[model samples]
Each structure stands twice: as structure tokens, then as C-alpha cells.
Target chain A: MSAPFAKLPRWADYGLIPLINLFVAFIVAGLVVMLVGENPFRAAMILVEGAFGRGQNIAYTLYYATNFIFTGLAVAVAFHAGLFNIGGEGQAYIAGLGVAFVALSLDTVLPWYLTFPIAIVAAAGFGALWALIPAYLQAKRDSHVVITTIMFNYIAGSLMVYMLVDVIKPLGSMAPQTRPFEAGAQLPKLNWIIELFGAKIRSAPLNLSFILALIMAYLVWLLIWRTKLGYEIRTLGFSSKAARYAGISESRIIIITMLISGALAGMMALNPTMGDQHNVSLDFVSQAGFVGIAVALMGRSHPAGIIPAAILFGALYQGGAELAFEMPNISRDMIVIIQGLVILFAGALEHMFRPTIQTLFASLSPRSVGLAAAKKEGA
Target chain B: MDFLNALVLILDSTIRLSVPLLLACLAGLYSERAGVFDIGLEGKMLAGAFAGAAGAAVTGSAWLGLLCGILVSVGMALVHGFASITHRGNQIVSGVAINFIAAGSTIILGQAWFQQGGRTPALGAAQRFEAIELPGAAALRDVPLIGQIYSELISGHSLLTYFAFLMVPFTWWVLYRTRFGLRLRAVGENPAAVDTAGVSVAWLRYRAVICTGILTGIAGCYLSMVQNAGFVKDMTAGKGFIALAALIFAKWKPVNAMFACLLFGFLDAASIRLQGTPIMGVRVPVQLMQALPYILTVILLAGFIGKAIPPRAGGVPYVKER
Candidate 1:
């Protein structure tokens, strides 16, 4: 293989890959919808409308994006550290429990000013603690973090169910969730901002959580690209033996990275708990942890990349929900197909796009493959 | 008599629960031993489960369904092998993708086929794997300890259960005693060295993965046809992952993997038993009992057990220089 210099054509190179992947995802989804006797075009239209057709839908998309941002950032942090942290689900579950407990327990005694921040902190702390176990194992025992974290998700979910049903039954409620937090414990809405747009526009329950998500994303960017600690993390992630040789403690970095990642996952609960929901519930965590993996992959594991990726996912999620509601035939399973496709394209076929596109363009052009490139250089 | 009864119950449940895991883990053992990580076992098994259920429901033949399950899972394994082996893609990502695809496609197909909303039609007794009591075992039940031991150790299981148990020794024999086993171990430890020695590393790993797919398919079929009588969407749950953990905790040895499967199975059975029994003057919530196996896996991995080393090059793809 002499250098392997075939490259993607300039005109269709950047935009074509995403478009091809989007087409693939929609086609797969269309097949499934069609199998269920639903019109594919109508279902696709419904999905688009659900995500961005109206102001309310856009707000809902943003509301969902808030959780996606935190979870996506959490995954990106660990991915940067070269660790696959599948335990985001478990950490988020534990953090949700922490949020619920703090919100409910402190609602009566503490004022909103102090309670909200404390609750968010408690959730993050709990999330960090949850991640600590797997980090310790990976650091000390050389156990794979992926297996341990996946197992912990089940453990965390079961533990939460047990706690909610038995020990923390919320006074008299029988549901597998805590009682609603007092009004003060909830995150205040941005209704005033929505009103500024005027004309009967009611913003969804999106709140300050979106700002916190953005801040966390920025903080992750700083930590990964700007700070010394971030340098140590990236070095260790690239090659642990090299990092160790370079005088960085791989164990310490692993533990710290996991802690930060878990804390971000824990913060994800803020969107659901502090928004109009006002309480943490089982459905609140709803695969946000898993979807974070897709977000991180779509974003190419960069903080700047993750914002658009999260919004894209948020749109898909919001749209899928709308499709389900509007068309009784299409189930929420279509979203799973779309997610799976996005992840497949963004992850497995990621590197192949440039080569594949180059090959296609080369075949389409009558001239020799190197001729176009030579012409461009000559120009 | 009561002790004998409890032993029998435990043994029966152990065999039933351990079959799926044993097959899956043993499959995992072969793949990992050949230097390929198989996190897609869960997805492969789910695919198998759905295929088995659908095949059985349509054809009304459990045997054909089992074959169908294996075929579907093998198809998935081929995809996994191609992606990781040929394309040199990330094993973890490929496995996760297979899982998501399996999960989504199964439910989508299940809804379309069964019209029961992601669950299959329940099979008749003949369509399920019936328990097989050994010949002359009926007389052995009259004896005291021997009867209990005979029944608990030797009798009362589906044919697949015995097959799963026998696979442990068979796997060990293959790994330690056979030429192919030596080559597989060699490849897993150092594919470059194996390649230097003229063995095709990619071919060996691909075979190991296919073997895993077949075994996991049997495991998934067992779940649908015997354990639950039919398939429920996502019913295999995380059992495949639990089996993977067991494979790791056992250090990837076939016999140790069997013991690990039993250990987990016992915890599973014990949890179910404990849920009925009172703990410290109060009944333990069923959810805690349900969580026992996963909690134990985490605890065992977290330095409670001694070091558990994975096979060298377990997740790395083999790229041959032309």
C-alpha cells in the first residue's frame, strides 16, 4: 500500500457523510414503520414536527437536550480519559435518588436559595461515589470498567426501587417514587424570556439547568484542552505506560476522571428534578445515560462537537415521542432504530466515509483518481 | 426429607438458571481466549431468543426454533466478527451497536409478527423443553443421602442443561489437550507471534466468535423454550453481561467459568428464596433480592476477590501485514 492517498472529493466531502448516515437511519426507521402498517413519510413528518414544528415542541426539545448535555459531557470526559464508562446509567440513577432525597427532605426547612444548590451538589456527590467503585477496581485490580459499570446499572436500579418502596416510601404514597418537592425546591422557570417572544408562547419546563449544562460542557472543554490536569488526563488516555513513564500517576488520573465524569452524570438529574417535574422519578433517567454514548460519539468526543450532537439527539428524542403520540401505529421503538443507526454510522463507519466517498467520486469522475487532486493543486 | 427436598429444589433451579449463562459464558470463553471481546453476547442471545420464539411459534417445532435461533445469532456474530476483524473497528462500539440493533429490531419484529406488543405467543407444553428424569432415578429417590445426591446432581433437567454442564469439561479438554486449543491460546496471548508461526489469527478468532454465537443461541433458545415457555421482549435482560462478568471473574477457564455460573445461579436462587424469608424481623424487599447477583459481581470485582486477569489481546483486532 503506497501511502494510500485517495481522498474524499471537495464538494460533497464534509456534508455528504452526515447526509448519507441520516438517509440510512431514516431508511431503516422507515422499514420498521412500514412493517407496522404506517406510512413512512407521514411518520417522518410527524417526527420533524414533534421536534421543531412549534415553540412548545422546541422548548421540550431543549428540555430533553439539557439532560443529554450533562450525560453526553460525562461520557465525553471518560472517553477522553480512554475509559469506557458504561456506568453512567447507574451513576445517574443513584444521583437521581440523591436529588429526590435532598429535595424532599430539605424542602420544608430550607429556603429555595440554599436547597436547590445543595440538592444538585448532593446528586453530583452521589453520582461521583457511584462511579468511584468501578474506578477503584479499574485502577487497582485491572478490572474492565465496561463490565463493572454495566453490572452496576442493574444494581443501582434495583437499589433505587428497593429504597423507594421500603425505606423511603414518601410518607403515604405507594408509587415507586418520592413525594413531590415543595415549590421552592424546584428550579425557577424562564417564562419571562419565553414571554419576551410574545403572542401566546408558553415555554416548556426548560429552566436554568440548560445554562448549567453549558457551563459543565465549557468546564469539561477547559479541563480536557486547557488545564494541566486535562493534559495529564489526555496523556494517560493515549497511553498509560507512556504517561507513567512521563511521571504522571495513571491510577490517580483514572480515579479523578471517573469522579468528574460521574459528577457530570449526577448533575443530569437537575433537568428533570428541578424543572416542572419537581421530583425525581423512574422515567426521569430514561436511557439518557445510554443515549449519552451516542451523543459523545456523534460529537466526536469534543465539547464543542457535543452541543450540536446533543441538540440533534434532543430533536430525535422529542420528535420520536411526538411520532408515537400522533400516530398510534408507530411505537417509541423507532427512536431506538434511529439512535442505533446514528451510533453505527457515527462510530463504526466514521472513518470509512472519507475513503468510501473518495472511491465513489473517483469512480464517478472519468479522469484518473489522482488527476482531480493534481488539478486542484495546479489551480 | 426436608433437607433432601431443599437440596433438590436448589439443584433443579441451579441447572435451569445456569444453562443459559453457562452456554453464553463458555461461548465468551472461546472468543476471549482467542483475543476477541464479546460484549455482544447479550444482543446475540436476544436475537436468538426472538428468532427461536418466532420460529417456534410459526412452525410449531421447538427443535427447528432452536436451530433458527442459532442461525440468527450466528448471523449477528458474523457481523461482529466482520466489523472487528475485517474493518478493525472498535470491539466495544461494534458490540454496543449489535446490542442496540438486536434490541430495536427484535421488538419491532415482535410487534409486527406476534401482534402481542413485543411478546411472543406462549407455547404449548410439547413446544417447551420438558424435564428429563434419568432412568432408574425413580427408585433412587427412596434412598436417603444417595437418593438426594443422585436427584440433585444427576437428574431432573432439560437435555440442554446436561449439554451445558458437559461443555465445561469438553471446553477444558479442547483448550488444554487439543492442537486447535493450543493455537487459540497462542493467538489470544500474542497474535503477532501466532502469525509469525504461520497460523491465521483472524480465522481462529472468527471461528471462536462463531462458536460463541452458536452457544449463546442455544442459551437464548433455552430461555425462550424452557425457562420462560416463550419469549418476552428483552427478557434475557442483562444475563449475557452477567455471564461475561462470570467469565472474567473465573479468569476465562472453562471449569472456573462453570463454577462462577453456579455461584451466580446460587445467588440468583438464594435471592428468590430470601425474598420469602424474613431478615432481621422484616421481610427483605424483593428488589434487593433481585439485585443480589449484580451487587455480588461488583463487590467481587472490587478487590473482594483476588486479581482476575483477562486474556491478553482480548479486545484488540488482528491486522495482518501483506
Candidate 2:
């Protein structure tokens, strides 16, 4: 074998790799579809159409994308800071519960405008607090954030089940969920825009929550690329020792990064409660947090990349539901299989493809000069 | 007599619960000691449980099922080892992949094979592993205090329970007393040094992970064939993580891990007992009791347990320089 260090790819070469990775991923996805006895072309067409074939379908897809945006941004923020953040699920859970409490308690008395801001703030605050514990442990005692956050997710799940089943059960109902929010508490829909699509689109709940998600995405981008704090986060992410030499406090960065990630995760709850489902329900936020990991990975952990990645995932999710309805034999789980394969291929893409590309490029340019040398000589 | 009874009850519950955790923790100890972070323990356990139950249901022998469970889990461990050790993939991502596959595939297979709605058919009492009653323990039953403790605490668990306890000391001996143990530690701490000394770091880590798989299989089989007598979807529920915590909390020492498992098991038992019990003149919701173990784990891990250090190079894959 050659020198072990010789195989390592330079950091600058990572930019063009994602596009090739995505193309390879789609090829793999096609193979998977063929294995499942479906025509890849038909399946791909149907999937795209299901997401955007009709105006209402497009609206619903965007609605799903809104939640993914928040959670994906949450995971990306931590990924940028070198944190895995498996606890987005738990943070979102607590934040959702916080939103529910505020929505139910203040719905009757507070005006719609006042109640909406209060609910969003409460959700974000609760999420930040939920994340603070694991962050503190990791910073202070060197505890592994992955294990701690996962434990907290289980605890959060159980607590939510308990709250829904016993404490917060609706007064007159036996259902294992909270009561629906009052009319005043619901986020106002974009009714005027829906008039153009006629009666079909009016039924879907397209509210102000999607706008909030977009704004949050833009803000996250600014925070990650523009600010001094962002510089510290990225520096520490690349190398902790270098960040320390640069006089950035690692502990403070960890805490602040986690809090910001948690707050973004908290905002994800608004998509279900205030937009699509119109209330805090147990099934409303199923595995959105876990799916965020895939979103972040597919997006290459960038804010702008996250939007399209979220839309892709949202399309697949909606398409899967439609397939389940149309073909009962296939089951809804094929989407999970697709999601798993996408993640597997995408995560391994860099390791698998970088060397192959370098070798291919090396053969084409026989002098064996590196890419940087070639570019410098050309310049 | 009352005090002895309470002590016996606690001891019995502790042993019963701790066996699974202890086995899994020791398994984690081996894997981490060889520098592979085995977070797929829960998924492996679930796979083992499903395979074990299916094997027993078909073969009509619990022992055969136990062996089958170990074999299936070893397959999973091999996959994990190959992905992380051979392919040099991210250990955490590979572990997560195994977990997702296990979670979905097991339930799908169970539903298809058993027609039991994501659960295996329950085993009859005779088909399950029987508890061993020590000879002369019945005669000691008349002694009031010590007799109750002896009969209840030591004599009535399945043979696997006894083996689990024995493995703790055996592990300690192997980890500290044997040449393999030293090499294993060296590989985890500094694989480059081990490679320089002419030891195959990859082979050692592979063996360590395989051992973890076997132990995890036993824990899973014990849960399904002996303790609960059936399999359920995602039944291991984060016990693998709890065991990981115990492994860390004990500083990856066998004896310390034994006690940590016991402490966690006792909390689990106490949580069960606390349900439906009145506290402060009001009945407490059982969910709070159920959440106690996780809450305690979080608190303990959050700067309260002094400092728990992971093995250096714990999750890094070793590639031998030729």
C-alpha cells in the first residue's frame, strides 16, 4: 500500500463532490426501485407528480417542506459546530408541548396577534432549555452529547405520551391528545392566494408558518456565514485546538450553538400545530426530527442547500402516502427504504467517489500533478 | 422475616434485570475496548430476540433458539465490523444504519412469519427456560431469615442468569489477567503502537465486536425466551444505551460495571413498584415513575458522576499501514 496520508483528499475538492454524489444516489435509487419490481421511470414520474401535479399537492408539499426546513436547519447548525445533536426530537417535543399549553391556555382571552407570538416564543424558549442540559454536560464534564441526547428523546417521548394520555386529556374526550385550539389561536391562512386555485386548494392549510420557516432559513444562513460567533463555530468545528489558539472559548461556543440549534428545532413545531394539522397532536410530528438528520446530510449542511433538500424529502413523503393509498399491497414503508438508501449512499459518497474521481482525473492528466497545481499553472 | 423478605425481593429483581444489562454492558466493554463504538446494541438485541423466538417456535427447543439468536446477531455485528473496520465508514452512521434496518426489518419479518401483528406468539411455560432450584434450599426454608434470602435471591433464576453473573468476574480476569486483554486495551488506546508491535489491530477489534454480538444475543434471548417469553417490536427500547451509560459510568471496568448495572436495575424495579402508590397523599402518575431511569441517567451524566472518560480512539476505525 502507498503512504496512508496520500489517500486523503484536500478540503477544497469537497465542493463539486456533492453533485456527483447526488447523481450516483439517484442511480442507486433507480436500482432499488427495479429490485422492488417497479418501473423506475414510472415510479419517479409518479413521485414527482404526486408532489407537484396539482396545485393543492404543491401546497401540501410545501407545507411539509416548511417543517423540514426548521428541523433541517437545526441539525445543520449543530453539524457545523461538530455536534451530532440526536436530541432534536426531544427538544421539539418539549417545544411542542410548550406551544400546546400556551395555545390552549391563552386562546380564549388573547388576541390572535398576541397569542401567535407568545406561542412561538414559548416553543422556542422551551426547546432551547431542553437542549441546554446536554450542552452543559458536554461542555463541563466532557460527556458524549450523542448518548445524552438520545436518552432525552426517550424521556421526552414517554413524557409526551403521559401528558397526552393523562394530564392534558381533553375535558370531554377519551382521545389520547389535547383539545383543538380555539379559532382565535389558529394561524391565518393565505385565503386570497388560494382563490386563484379555486375550491381545490382552499381546503389545504397554507398559513404564515411557511413564511416563518423561510425567514428562519435566511437568518440561519446569515448567522453561520456572516457573524463572529459563526466564525468561532466553524473554526471549532474544523479544529478545536486551532479555535482555542485563536482565542475563541470552546465551552461558550458549544452552549450557544446548541441553544440556537434547539431554538430552530422549537420553531419546527409551529408547522404542525399552526399550519397543517391545526393542533398539537401526537402523530403530528412523527420522526420529523430523525428525518432531519437525512435532510442535513443530503443538504451538505448548508442553509441554501437545505431548502431544496427539504422539498425533495417532502415530495417523497407525500408521494409515499399517495402510493400507499393507491396500491395497498406495497405498503407505505417503501418510502423509508428509499430514505435509508439515500442516506446510505449520500453519507458514503465522499469516501467512495473522491478517490475514484481523483484516479480518473489523474489518468486524464498524465503528469500526476494535483488539481491545485494544475489550476495554479493554468492561472 | 419481613426484612429478609424485602431484601430477597430486591435481590431477585436486581439479578433478573441486571443480567440483561450486565451482559450487554460487558459486550459494550469489549467492543469499546477495541475502539469500536457499538451503538447498535439495541438493534442487535431486537434482532436476536426475533430470531430466538422464531427459532424456538419452529424447533421447539429454547436452547437451540438461544444459539440461533447469537448466530443472527453475530451476522449483524459482522456487518457493523465490516462497515466500520474494513470500509472505514463513520462508526456512528453505520451503527445508526444497522439500527434503522433492524427496527424496520424485524417488525416486517415478525408480522409476516408469525401473523402476530409485530409480536411473536407467546411461549408455553414448559417451552421456556426453567428456573433452577438448588438442592437443600427447600430445607433451608424453615430457618426464617437467612433461609428466605438464600432461596429467593440465589436459587430460582434460569441458568443464563447464573452465567451472566459468572461472566462478570470471568471478564475481569480476562481483561486484566490475559495477554489478549492487554492487546485489546492497547488497540483501543493506540492502534498504531499495537501495529508497530506486530499485532493485528483489525483482527483484535473484530474479535472484540464479535464477542459483544454473542453477549448481546444472549441478552436478547434471555429477554424473549426466559424473562418475557415472547418478542415485541422495539422491546429493547434504549436499554442498550443505558448499558452503554453503565459501561461509561464504570470507567469501562468489569466489576464497576456490575454495580452500575445493579444500580440501574434497582431504579427500574423501584420505578415499577412506585406505580399506583400514593406519595404526599396523592396518587402519582405512573409515567413519572417510568421516566425516572432516563431522568436519573441524564442527571448522572451531566457533571454529577465526577468524570467518565471514554477509551481514547473509541470510535475511530483502524486501517493497518502495510
The 10-residue segment of model 1 chain B with minimum total lDDT is B267-276
DockQ of 2: 0.35
Off by over 4 Å in 1: A2-22, A35-37, A191-203, A326-329, A358-379, B148-153, B279-289
- True-structure RMSD, every candidate: 3.3, 4.0
- Best candidate according to DockQ: 1
- The CAPRI-style docking tier of model 1 reads medium
lDDT of 2 by residue, B216-250 (tens): 99988888888888888878877887787788778
lDDT of 1 by residue, B177-259 (tens): 99999999988999999999888888988898899899989999999988988899888888898898888778789998999
Q: Which DockQ values do the candidates obtain, in the order shown?
A: 0.55, 0.35
lDDT per residue (tens digit) for residues A14-133 in model 2: 455666766766676667556545677877777787888877777777777888888899999998998888788888888888889898898888877888888889889988888998
C-alpha lDDT (0 to 100) for residue A77 of candidate 2: 96
**Candidate 2 docking band:** acceptable
lDDT of each: 0.83, 0.79
**lDDT, candidate 1, residue A16?**
64
Expressed as tens digits, the lDDT of each residue in A1-379 for candidate 1 is: 3223555554454456656766776687788788878899988788888888877777778888888898899999999889998788889889988888788878888887788789879989999999998999899877789988888888898888777777666777867777788876878776456557662445588788888899889999989999999999999889988899999998899999999999999999888877768876666688899889888887777888788889988988889888878776556776776777677666665655566666666657725456565645644
